[model samples]
Target chain A: MNAQADLNTTVPVELIDEFLKRIPYVSEGITNVRLLDGAQRVMFDLRPGFENQRDLVASRISEIADKLCLNYRPGSSRVLVKREALPGSYRQDPHAELQQRGDIIAFGRGRYGFGPKLVRLIEFFEQRSREMAASFQADPYNFPALIGADVLDTCRYLKNFPASLNLVSHLREDHSVLQEFSQSVRWDGEQLAYDRNGASGVECLLSPSVCFHWYRWLRDVELKEPRAITALGKCFRYESSNLTGLERLWDFTMREIVFVGPAEYVLASRDRLVDLSARFLDELGMAYEISTATDPFFVDSYAVQAAYQQGFELKFELLAPLPYSGKKLAVGSINYHQDFFGRSFAIQAAGAPAHTGCLGFGYERLALAFLAQHGLDQKQWPAALDAAITASAAHDKA
Target chain B: MTSSPNESIEQRIAGAVMRALKIADPGSSTPLRMGSTPGWDSMGHMMVVMELEKEFNTRFPPYLLPQLVDVEAIAKTLRKPA
Candidate 1:
């Protein structure tokens, strides 16, 4: 059996919900939120402890789908929002949850969405690796590390405002026709001012990072227990307004594992992710080299940013050639955000602030890289690559 | 799932949810906040409430959907007795 098959056979029911509750904030670092619907609905219901919640949510979804059948195709409807439960309904209706049983690979919010998207990405990267090895069979060159999507962005609002929907209202006040999926939009025009100590309502143009930022009012929130490791989906950038195709997406799934402890322990945890990433690729016969990289967030800063871009390399980006993009796309990164995020969240241990770092893997990017290394057509994929891919799925089901 | 005329306020509640789900990217990990993240523009807010109406199949009163700022608030309004 493959890794996916193994996951299916071993993990008991309710694991997903338990994971969700532990995370607290599925949407970014925002507390108390999660998405409850997507592609794989039925398989999750039949999996293990969640036989109840899976059935309930699935049944509700099925009823809604049947009613809406006259309008749309199956499996395209949005079910429930992630928030507080209804007055009489169970906050977590065990009977209504799905078993989370498909595509061993997890997606957004760690909910339902294991589909062909992931399978295709994996196939593409694997193919690329095989071709590289064949070409280098006679010569010698270092294999590239894989980087997943964790493109970080920073922002400053138009005006000092509370973290609320009012920010959206402010944008609406300026323009009424902007689309719904517009990730970031800014205003222009400079201030007409004279030299003064404090100019009244002075307007200064600010460069905004057109990326996602957290807004939930929270503090001292813990993403994991003192010592827990996990991997899950994370979004990259979204595509165009139409919202079609995987590459065009602004948000993509991320396989992020966080560690908290002393600096040494944290570094050790990061090494584990790197080791696993290389091992996973190596098992499929892909050669790769692990390098060091710094945090993507501090890119625009002064000395540290320049060091990362020019000299002191702490952050590492995995780069491999792709047939689709025709460039070295990043598959993942090993980063050490020592004490930064921990301080921001007020997380502490041993009478001092904790150190935090994450090893992010772009599962889709890895899949894509594999496809580019191997061959796009499944029939043409190398025997070993094919076997490994199938093995992963089988492992999930075991 | 049927509601009465006195429950029109409930329709407004539903309207907000529809607008919330449709406007935001289903794949996003960031919280869906107005004017904070990229897509939550004017039309985005309108779409959120509009989709909410579709979800509940009910029309909301004027200025009803915008009142909701987060999912918890939406659930609170929806669970209230008409």
Candidate 2:
């Protein structure tokens, strides 16, 4: 078929149907499908993927709301989840204090900011905790404490995403992409200096979610066979001049993984995740490039403990080139953290230290990039992309 | 993360002091007052107090709330040895 026809092709619903069929016991969780102007969205039950049966149906709905910029007029949407009864106390921002206890905060930015959509987002996070619980098949009490501890510390950007250094070391020695294209940073005391009190100067630290994820993994698997998939909302240092749309955010979201195992299996798994993530982007009709991340400290900084963080930068950034920004933002990344975390966490197996690796996706970046590719007008958007999104919604329902 | 408890109490109070003076930065070391800083008016003073409390990891007596007016005074309340 020609290119135009190919572009116009309606992705067969069968493909999405087939995709859902393969996953065990997952049912469609979507509610209603609506289009606001050119923005298309489908509300879905943001059910926790875990067995605790924690309902996040509303949280899932807000993610869609944010992605599509839906202004969910109150009284229009009903949440199965309640807010004021939430166990934790929120610091009151008098200027932005939410009046209603059950009200969910939405849009940390924008006119329709901080409402049910935001509430749903928090609900989504709550559900995610439940999902994590499901992954380990762990008990209920073990779940909330682990999830709630740093839940409030949730922010954007993750710095020093402590990875498996030994694994990355092994990968660098082997992978061509890593060996050549890695970037490094060095502090001259001029370029970067210590924040004496965190007190004296303004310092932005990356999200602690990755580190927290590591802490949680250690708690669960306990040194034998450790595995975890963590989704963390992250913020990064961005130039004010470079900021435009979601392409450049002082903050962003990053989903990273740390798995410790045999080298061969881990390498294969990394490739599989890359492929799976690519397929996900394809379904979104977005283009991407996979590049290796370069952390200069991965090699030399080992001798000095603090040197590693003093000079840290990403080894790889999966970028989706955009026309609007004339540049690409990292949408996803698959990093091989050979042993930094394993050694730090003292994870061992069979009396030998384990090798670890991580795969990450910048979920928000991916969504924004997809939006960039598809054009704002829903009518002009490719049918395949539309179909895939619809399928995502429908899949939720099933 | 790069903070030390011994680093001058003045440095520690910078963030909080800025909130009370309502000044984000005086541009130089010039002192800031409550109405001077962007977004720091009467309404923001509470947030400033909360921020100061969290950063110092200590709470001020509720009656002392009115006493926190300027940078120097806020500095006095901060534990010494800045």
Candidate 3:
């Protein structure tokens, strides 16, 4: 059904892109949304039966626009690095090929199981990142998928991103509670149903980002010198209706190189990572742009938090083109925390709260973007990536 | 509900800060910095901004939010011609 709403106020041109990104999450029934009359109106393509809810959806959209679109002054989003499309590159749908070849299996919304080809691609990206980390003498570590809720609280994730949190809970340990849960649990066609009383208080959450665990691991420690650590871990964020294909996921692999030291050292490390990342992407011959970015904060706090982030130029994202869609996906980021985490965790360096920075690459998005630009054929891939894949395959055989 | 004519911008700002933090007046001499002061965290900073806007009847530009780290900064910003 066709439904549309005109926002009462005009959203600035600069904020329109960000406003559109947040539209899908406003309502599950909003299948798609498009701009009308420049940025003053929005047309929503609704799911069947959602036409009845049009006014409600429109009101929510207006509320969001008021909070996120009009309240903040736009910061200059400077593009730090840009690469043009490869000479012979052409747009193709890699998702279809991956699905047809059983390279990826969709289990549910925003969840997928990958076959060997995609898995190998992810490993290749990981190895390259590890090589980069090695150049900085960064110690490698592996962290568990779950992080204590308290750790996230300390990171203030609840304050800025309350909407994206995914809490983990289990049945209460009492035998009676377990028996009650076992007796009552059943599939209700859409979701599992059970007695709510049997569920325990959630003490842990799926880790939202990999670097936070590194900060937690080094909590309250005094560093004699600057320390760099690299880790690969699964991170989870609830993206609601915004999740699609490999671009946005509820659970994804992230490789993070973290620096903990004085402010100058951490900032230098972030800058170095950005330079290295540009060279690496150039070697792969991908079309990409690295630019200043802000986090997707909850709408209530979006204006203040995003303004703060962009005002100070605290984050930069490495965005690769989605060839077929004419859109760009952020596959990596470089962020400087500037003593935020150090003070939270009481980590010390140079007799003061340590500054921190991290560079993270989402392996799945990177591989997907690579496939979309390079195509399913290995021969079409960049020589550097081709050589790495070939060498990895040879090592597997040997 | 008018502020005392003799009240300094610093005093007005301090009152706003105290109201936002829900604390007793820390007196005029006590200096409050964003990260150093108790309860003046990010959320507290936002509340303080809101209170200052209400107290002064003026809105701050978003970029200026990060620069309002201390009373002096806030006073300096408010003193500027809008």
Candidate 4:
């Protein structure tokens, strides 16, 4: 049964192809396959998806082992092993109690609305954000929440995040064309048939991150000195089953302060931001841990880049325990772009590619963390947050 | 149910790696370390592991693949009864 026990000669191509076809792996993202150089060299080009594609790969490899009579031993692989997927989904909210009492409302998957108390809680975090930015002397700026599709392409957002990119398009100007396109829309049944032949092509994409504004502004511009800016904006990302409450969202608000300058300056700024964030968390009296992390937005080759980023400690997240799922959630992050933005935008600092870094805080996530730790009772909340709520309630009465 | 007594762990590992790597000269000194040899790439490593499991009737964890540097390392991990 062991074909070519010595392996000195080549195996037949048909058998290898059969092994590949029989392999129990999801072929959704595979773009290429090479089976030469032995069965061990079988590699498939897999694009990144929201789920851990590696798990599927490992499972398939195990199945291949079973068929080939290969043994798959544990404790002998990569250090980054997969963990048990967290419990709950869009259908199963772990914080159903919060939803029942009207503390938080799930508008739908990737969307949520807050009641009065949660709003006040979010407002308290807003004050903390203002204090944090003011301390950093961040030059505040706001850009259109929707970025032009051409602008996104120029920024390499499309290349890096084609899976998550949400393009904004519109119907054709002619009503007759709209009527014709209406066939794509299902009144009784669900249909996505939209006749784009008459409609305008995708003109804009929802902004995935707030820093796109700063990079787009500095396009073709040379900076004589370092520039710092703080921005708060709504951002969008497409999540699969990973989409939970505030932990993972299709759309959420991000408060960020980005710095672009020489590498040394950017590194120093990032260190300072990390230190400042730690202090801000301390001020709020929230228990958090600053841990090295990476943006889960990338896959395949980009996944390697993400691993490299994590290896170098370039991205750090402040994780806090959340009430839902009873798991720690990354509430904020500090990132060192390492000239990624500068090279993409033609931004030069000191006659070299500008090194960039950013500090981003998620207000909604913080609110959720607060609720997780402090619970739904306002009186039982942390002092500063409770005080803010009391003052706002008093003001409303007045 | 068992490999032939003459078929040693080193022989099995070397055979699997040689097959995966396609080294014509068995005695040729091209280090079997990962990222060092042409056949020890990530994909090759997985294949060697699969083949090794079958040849030696031993299971190898995913993390252990990176550490199984060469024939010697695989032999040591396989640890067939002397």
**Which one is best on DockQ?**
3
Interface RMSD of 3: 2.5
lDDT per residue for candidate 4 within A33-145, as digits (tens), equals 45546655445555666235645564554444344332212121122112223211222333676789887788777789877877887777777777777876788899778
- Tell me the tens digit of each residue's lDDT in model 3 across A1-398: 77777787788877787688778877778976888896878888889877788888888888888888644766678799999665356688788888999999888889999987888778778878999999899999999999999999999897778768899999888999988888888999868999888888999999999999989998989999999999999999998777888888999999999999999999888889989999889877788999999998878878777776776678999999888898889999999887889889999999988999999999999988888888888877777777888888888889
Candidate 3's C-alpha lDDT? 0.85
Relative to the true structure, candidate 1 has a C-alpha RMSD (angstroms) of 26.3
Candidate 1 residues lying further than 4 Å off, grouped into runs, are: A1-226, A236-249, A294-312, A323-326, A379-385, A388-398, B1-82
Arrange candidates by TM-score, descending: 3, 4, 2, 1
lDDT of 2 at A213: 49
TM accuracy, model 3: 0.87
DockQ of each: 0.01, 0.01, 0.36, 0.14
In model 3, how large is the Cα lDDT of residue B8? 90
Second chain only: TM-score per model?
0.54, 0.68, 0.88, 0.71
Each model's TM-score, in the order given? Answer: 0.37, 0.38, 0.87, 0.64
Cα distance off (Å), candidate 1, residue A297: 5.4
Candidate 4 ranges beyond 4 A from true positions = A1-94, A181-198, A323-326, B1-82
> How many clashes (backbone atoms < 3 Å, residues ≥3 apart in a chain or on different chains) does model 2 have?
45
CA shift at A12, candidate 4, in angstroms?
A: 31
- The best candidate by lDDT is 3
Lowest summed lDDT across 10 adjacent residues in model 4 chain A is found at A72-81
lDDT of 1 by residue, B7-26 (tens): 55544444354345444333
Cα misplacement distance, residue A50 of candidate 4 (Å): 20
User: In candidate 3, which residue ranges exceed 4 Å CA deviation?
Assistant: A1-6, A20-57, A180-184, B1-82
